[model samples]
Target: MESTLQIMPVQRTSRNFGEYAEEAVIIEEPIIKQKRPLFIEANTIEASLEHLRNDCIIPVFAKDNEATLSHVAFIEVVQDAT
Candidate 1:
């Protein structure tokens, strides 16, 4: 079986509070946006890195999405322990 690498986007938010002079203080809350996991073909650890570099997997995964490779996390490699 071929190995697979799982990558997901990370979200971040900023808070804006009105000045003390302002009558109404605006309190913003942090919002976290999640995206679907992206799977890549990786038969081994080295192959995984090669795919990420040669294939430019970052943009491929970020295409038409706000997420970026920097936000990618939970990189999992599924292999048969035989």
Candidate 2:
């Protein structure tokens, strides 16, 4: 008898959860804006495309280490868009 195995993919949620609201004047008007920070990572460009869709982040800056493995970290700018 033979058995079959099924492989599943990872589901990602929205990592961005930071925003900024502002009011210029008291009796004039109000303004609101949101800051969106994003980080995209993967082994190859093909896989990175999938990460972009899942994480909503574009690979702006990148660094390839020849002696270390890749990793991720959260920032204090707008959100943990990674």
Candidate 3:
């Protein structure tokens, strides 16, 4: 069966600077759709992750059925920001 994945905003930032400290600042914005990861649908989280890795797509996280494959949807992504 085919499925559809939802796309969301992924925030990113960059440092902007000119000739002086007055112009130095951090610019934050949502990542561009063109540069964002492509949505992929799969029956299982494992399969989805495998496909992402195989395609060299780095996902911040994704939604999938429960670990028991009970068809209960949930967010399944981990972030460890130091």
Candidate 4:
């Protein structure tokens, strides 16, 4: 199994000059799919994301298990200003 989670760094503007700031990471974990730590160990998170994007099939608890949906979701990356 593979997870479709992506932990990206959050970028923010410093109150100061032209310098850029990087805060905490924001994860965009897949809503329709989940994987365990073993899967993460088998492949890096990045590899897992790529594989999930291509080969993973998302299960649908909706439609009384009679249907499946192509789940592609994203979330905004944010962090504390401080």
Q: What local distance difference test score does each model get?
A: 0.52, 0.47, 0.47, 0.58
Off by over 4 Å in 2: 20-82
Model 1, residue 19: what's the lDDT? 48
Off by over 4 Å in 4: 1-46, 65-82
Regions of candidate 1 where Cα sits further than 4 Å from its true position: 1-48, 59-64, 70-82
State TM-scores per candidate. 0.17, 0.17, 0.18, 0.23
Q: List the residue pairs that clash in candidate 1.
A: none
Query: Model 2 compared with the native: what TM-score?
Result: 0.17
* Per-model tally of clashing residue pairs: 0, 0, 0, 0
Ranking by TM-score: 4, 3, 1, 2
Model 4, residue pairs in steric clash: none
Give a tens-digit lDDT track for model 2, residues 1-82.
Answer: 9999989998988865455545556585667775654444433354453454466543343464333222222222224553
Query: Best by lDDT, which number?
Result: 4
Which lDDT tens digits does candidate 4 get at residues 1-82? 9979899999996687435666769999778765556865778555344566578777767758764544333211222232
* Top-scoring candidate (TM-score): 4
Report the lDDT of model 1 for residue 40.
Answer: 46
Superposition error at 44 for model 1 (Å) = 6.7
Residues 17-72 of candidate 3: C-alpha lDDT, one tens digit per residue: 55446755898998775654445533324546444445643334346532332111
lDDT of 1: 0.52
Better of 2 and 4 by lDDT: 4
